[model samples]
Target: MSNRLLTYNPETEGAEGGLLIMGAPTRAAQPQPSTELEELELGSAFLEATSTSELASVVNRILRHGALLAGKPIASQVVQHLGARLNRAGQSVRTLLAPPAGRSDTAPSEAMERITGAELEGLSDEDKEFETARAFVRFAMEAGRLAARAPSTQPPAAVATAAARVAARRHAPGLDFVQLVPGFRARRAIRRQSFA
Candidate 1:
């Protein structure tokens, strides 16, 4: 018997200097990609347009990419990604995952437990966090390749507000009502002459 799971059992007679029996190992099937996830591919335009936040959004989009990818789940995926990022930056996972004071129903209390699962129990908070962060970085980097279109180049709220204010000021002095009404000025002159 070669496999660790198998040991020599006396059920069958073993011949001296004969071939030994070994256990046949079974491999799990690999995951296949789906059409929806394939649709999210980042094109050249998207790669050039995305900022850090847009990259992060693309990562979220992956969770809903398709039936195959959706099985991975978003809450767990984000936790793992963010945790790892914090760890690599030499920050504590506690800072991100730990619940705030006097809060009974926080993200850590509710979401973390679901995402971590039983198998990951042995992992330290920092290790889990690191893994999570690494996942995020990987997703973000790959997201550019999967993006369908370039991000919008719209101006920020502040800039838009400023522009609006300038436009408002441009017309602020007021309208000329006398010139606006075609016959008002002539009517006023006739009234003035009659009164005099």
Candidate 2:
């Protein structure tokens, strides 16, 4: 009953009639630019996506433009859209989990510095969260700080301390799902012997 584009071909299907409403040509006919310079000219339209329709428009535009050049696919527009959404989500998570009135982005790095500078003995439950992020960031920021310090500082004790901090973090508010599985537990034995 509805009107739509139809196709008839004798070569492919022995003279069968088919409804061709939304085929590749239909998509490819959307007036996409042929060159990178033309694409660059549409910058504001690409980056100004706030809704799904707007995002899809940008993606479709890129795909169309790419199809003209070497028939390559352009999937990066979707990736860029997803990346923007994820950055906002990460910032929100950082803000909500951060200590009261503390910043979102700087909190993780700051927590790392604090634990590294402090004596590990008398920290409370909240301090344990800071210390956990600190230990993680320290191990990440400095290649072998834990390995170097653990021996002089005592291995089993440091590992146990790190393990305890990880556990405490597992119990903290707004951080129930993330568990710190020290990927370098193998290094602990070396630390134990060297420190002992």
Candidate 3:
């Protein structure tokens, strides 16, 4: 009986053995792309942007990609809000580059110039690039703050209820006994006999 139990059945074992021998060679798992590498590539593309419109487009693409990566509706909202800021910043850059018909070129308003520290008119290419990068960094900081403030998906009431359930479970060690025995009471009744 032991020999019969130990003996491998050809009908069942043959197929598995054959499959193991004939199986395709396994490949090594590939590593996932790093976010830092992606950020570097995006930064390079942003720096290469020639015009304000191009810059804004690059920024928009970055924000959209971020929103997709986050995989949340609030992330989409952050993208929309930041996208508007990027557009406004681009418009400001354009204004700084070429003052409007009525506005004097020498005295560009503080609000318009605030986005970019230096005047775009006479700065070197490197300086202009630095200013643009600085503006983007500022925008990114604001985006970080906004994302941090995103509302929780669960309602406050639901969160409180979940916390209360956890607390009850933790505090009541013998609750299972009271629940399992219908007639069992947590407190025992005391009976007193008076001396005659």
State which candidate has the highest TM-score.
Answer: 3
Which is the better candidate, 2 or 3, if ranked by TM-score?
Answer: 3
Q: List the lowest-lDDT window of 10 residues for candidate 2.
A: 19-28
TM-score for each model: 0.24, 0.22, 0.35
Q: How much is the lDDT of residue 171 in candidate 1? A: 20
Best candidate according to lDDT: 3
lDDT of each: 0.30, 0.34, 0.40
**Which pairs clash inside model 3?**
none
> Better model by lDDT, 2 or 3?
3
Candidate 3 lDDT over 88-145, as tens digits, reads: 5444444454566897645543322344434566666555544544444334433332
Q: Report the lDDT tens digits of candidate 2 across residue range 1-196.
A: 3332222223212213421111101122333224434534433443345565654554444334433432333233323432333223223333333556545645554443343444444655455444543332222211111111222233333333332233223222222223233347645754655446
Better of 1 and 3 by TM-score: 3
lDDT digits (tens) for residues 39-146 of candidate 1: 334322123323445444444443344213323322343334332332222122133344468666444432333332223355675455444333322333322211
Candidate 2: residue 74 Cα off by (Å): 10
Off by more than 4 A, model 1: 1-98, 103-119, 148-196
Model 2, which residues run further than 4 Å from truth? 1-36, 71-196
